[model samples]
Target: MSKNYHFIAIGGAVMHNLALALLSKGYQVSGSDDEIYEPSRSRLKAAGILPEEKGWFPDKIHQGLDGIILGMHARIDNPELIRAKALNIPIFSFPAFIYEQSKEKKRVVISGSHGKTTITSMVLHVLKSCGLDFDYLVGAQIEGFDLMVRLSDAPIIIIEGDEYLTSPLDRRPKFFHYHHHILLMSGIAWDHFNVFPTFENYVDQFSQLAAMTPEKGAFIFYEDDPNVKKIAAEVPNTVRKTPYREHPAVIKAGQTYLLTKKGELPISVFGQHNLQNLQGAWEICQNLGITADQFYESIASFKGAAKRQQILAKSDDSILFRDFAHAPSKLKATVEAVKVQYPDRKLIAVQELHTYSSLNKDFVHNYAHTFDAADVAIIYLNPKAVSLKKLELMDESTLRSGFKRNDLILFTETKKLKSYLENQIYQNCNLLLMSSGNYDDMDLTTLQKTINKQHS
Candidate 1:
């Protein structure tokens, strides 16, 4: 008999993907969410699993259900959760359930503050090119993957492991539940202000994860990061510790080519951070029994994960790119990447302060000098976002002072930002947008088109 599973708060990105994965695996799947948004809503509907009603229906939850999967969006008092508890149905957090499903396979968990999605995507790209069958769960949408999560009878599963709190009911970090057989640590920087509160508290989570690596497992880390090196060194002798740095690459005429024993391998992605991510992915692939020659040849065609240094539009002289870079370290690296990639072009870098940490007064100071590489630096924050986050509306002077840049341009209004961007002459320039949000739902495609047209 097919096992039946119910997902509470199914409109979430990973939640919907998991539901679809389970459904594809011949399991009976049902889900409910109080609110469903675009992409997720459309996907669930197409899969024939969109709940008849928006809110919870306790009648949907019965004793026949084999298990319940909870998302981070649900509250402790969620009615379906209450019903599930009453019926003694096994409730699994997202990460926990992922571990449960992949128990029979070797789990490779990519854990870090940033670059997790990119590394995971790179691994998947090479594995697919080599015709290796593997399941994966990545945070962002890769170019060829239809869904973010895939579960199958494959021999191994790659997961982009997040350190955020799991479900509302589970206080532990999500990575704790993964119990990875192989772990890849990308450089860590402090994030998630509300949950972590302090840098020490944040680092502790990674330390605990490192300590959890089993005797037979491997821990791959970035040697360039002092924190990563320190953590890796602490791991017992029983576990394998492998450290990697950025791959050797050279840029010629705005294109980057990896220097390999086989020869110069042309790739679509650029940036030092990306090179480092590639190296980490290469290490993981090598450990999985793939040769360097095959990995390099296959990875040459990888463009990049969506929004992680994704190119938006380009003209002969002016190019536009967008990245999901919010943290201070990522901001600095991204800005520098653009400057180095196109040294002749003037760089106009714009970023939106959307996350709770970015909006917090205490955290703003951490962004100092992050945009120094950009010829023109601009910061945008939706006033409504500040108010919604229950944060004080930070004035221009405050941000300027925090960034330690007197000439920084600040915009609270999306209209003004758009107008400013549209009016600018982008000749011999590159525009880079960095944010976790969509710039207050602005039409980025139209904006990029206008900029490119203006440039032409």
Candidate 2:
């Protein structure tokens, strides 16, 4: 095992998880980051491996280091990275190393523009429930899993296969490196426009990944998504292709259960997209020799991954849920899920335009008609954030013009959005705040508490 490795931009969730996994395996790990956030910050501290509070240090890149793992957040011109290069030390992008390390394990690569995190979590949940020990690298914190990333001498390694560029130096998508014995292409939607630039180009990445799987490998696909179905249909006869649909769901007295072929199985996760995620997980687990009974038993205790349809606060009548939904498809699915779960309750779906793609002036039109399912839809944008991302400014009017809902409310200031939420009548209403950001530094917990207080 390689020892004395250093991680560049180690404060990120994935970066820190890799650091901790290395630490657990008795490797001397050091890291640097320009900034850090909670959970990642505290977890690093707990591991007794917190990096120096400041930015990278070139002096830290000595010749004794075994290797350098570059995170996606770090630029190529990073000082320590340049210094490491000068010394001719080996460097591995996060995904490149993950692929190298898990080459022997039967890799199950879960890919999609959205719901990859949830699907990975769902499979891990079922695996754990069945007492099957497997290594995984998931995007979010599952309820029972102490760490989001795990590496071990297990026979299987399940990974959330992101379609984004691997690293600054490696342009191949992360999913490409995974030598998948079982490949699940959830669907392809246009995302990471800063990289792929066109819809067909984005779809091509998945097509390539599908082609990589061996003849004995199974390719699980979404039966409903046209892009996924089309791509899966194009694959050769050697790879076994399995298509999945949303698990049949019924909401009875505020509970969602899967109407499986075996029986009615209950789960802590709800919503139609999650139901689809469960279906995909079930098929993959089944292919791994897990029976339907074992899959349902594991799913019963799965409380969901962090920030993906996470219920932050709840009172008697109204609950506040926050999600990592910035894509048009995700936003639509999340809003529809909340509506279906509580048919009689009003829904306030608030979203922040924080991602580079979401903040793009030309791409805002893709969000048209997405939030029509919500009773009240709000989009919050900050010019400062736009400046930070260096994206073109899209004013409230230009954004509103593109949205099909004429009555859709828009806010440019965090304070105004906070105030509107504070003053609103939330009775018999469930508030769903969706974003890839903090909504311009506003406290989501404060909003959750404020809304719950009124209902209580």
Candidate 3:
């Protein structure tokens, strides 16, 4: 008989994908969410798993269900959760359930403040190219993959481990549950201030994750990041510790090519950070029995994960790109990457202060000089977001002083920001939209059309 599983708050990015994965695996899947966003909603509707209504139904839970998967969006007092507890049904957090599903396989977990998605996607692409069977759970939708989560009877599973809280009922970090046999630490920067509350608290989670690697397992880290270095040094000698640096590459006429003994090979992605990501992926692939030559050959066609340096439109003189860079370290790396990748073109970088940490007056100071590489820096924060998050209202002076950029342009209204961008001359310039949000629902297609016209 097929196992029956129900998802609470299943409309999330990974939650919906996980639902579809189970359905594909022949499990009887059902789910509910108080709110469902695009792509998730559309995908769930297509799969016939989308909730008929917007809210939860306690009657949906019963003793007949095999298991219950909980998402972080649900509250401790959620009615469905109460019913599940009363019925003594097994409740698994997103990461916990993923760990359960892949327990028999060798788990390669990618953990850090940034670059987890890129590295995971790179490994998946290479594995597919080599015709190796593997399951994966990446944060974003890659260029060629249809879903972000997959579960099968493969020998190995590649998981993008996150440091965020697992669920409302379980306060432990998500990565803590993965129990990785092989661990990769991309880099560490303090984030999720609302949960961790301090830099030391945030770093402690990574330390614990490093300690979780089995004695015979491998722990890979970026050698350059000081935070990663400190964590790597503390891990016991029983675990194999490997370090990776940026791949040797050269940029010619706006294209980045890896310098290999086989010769210079062009790739679809650019930036030093991405090269570092590639190196990390290569190290993991090596452990998985893929040869260096095979890895390089497969990586050449890897465009990138969605919203990680995703190009929206391009012309000879100008290009517009969007990235999900909200943290200070990621913001700085992305800005510098673009500027260094195209030295001749001016960089007009705009980022939205959407995350809870970014909008906090106390955390704002961390962003100091992050946008220094850009020729033009613009910051946007929707005023209603402040109220919605119940944070202290931020003023222009606080943001300017926090970023320490006297000339930074600040906008609170999406309309004004769009108008300001539409009026700019994009000739010989690059426009970078960096945010975890959509600039308060700004339409990208219309903006792309307007900007492409200006560039032409």
- lDDT for each of the candidates? 0.91, 0.87, 0.93
Model 3 clash pairs?
Answer: none
Candidate 1 residue-wise lDDT, 1-456, digit = tens:
999999999999899999999998999999999999988999999999999888998898999999999999999999999999999999999899998988899989999998898999999999999999999999888988899999988999999999999998998899998899899999989999889989989988999999999998999999888888899989998999999999999999899999998778889989899999999999999889999888988899999998988878888888889999998888999999889989999999999999999999889999999989999999999989999899998888998998988899999888889889877788888899999888977777666886568547
- What ranking emerges by lDDT with the best candidate at the front? 3, 1, 2
Q: Candidate 3 residues 1-456, lDDT tens each? A: 999999999999999999999999999999899999998998999999999999989999999899999999999999999999999999999899999999999999999998999999999999999999999999998877888989999999999999999998989899999899999999999999999988999999999999999999999999999989999999999999999999999999999999999999999888989999999999999999999889989999998989999989887778999999999999999999999999999999999999999999999999999999999999998889989999987787888899999888899899999888888888899999999998877976766886677636
Task: Give the C-alpha miss distance for residue 224 in model 3, angstroms.
Answer: 1.1
* Superposed model 3: Cα runs more than 4 Å off: 451-456
Positional deviation of residue 442's Cα in model 2 after best superposition, in angstroms:
2.1
Model 3 misses residue 319 by how many Å? 0.2
Query: Model 1: how large is the Cα RMSD against the reference?
Result: 1.3
Backbone clash numbers for all candidates listed: 0, 0, 0
Q: What's the CA error at residue 292 for candidate 3, in Å?
A: 1.0
The 10-residue segment of model 2 with minimum total lDDT is 443-452
Cα-lDDT of candidate 3 = 0.93
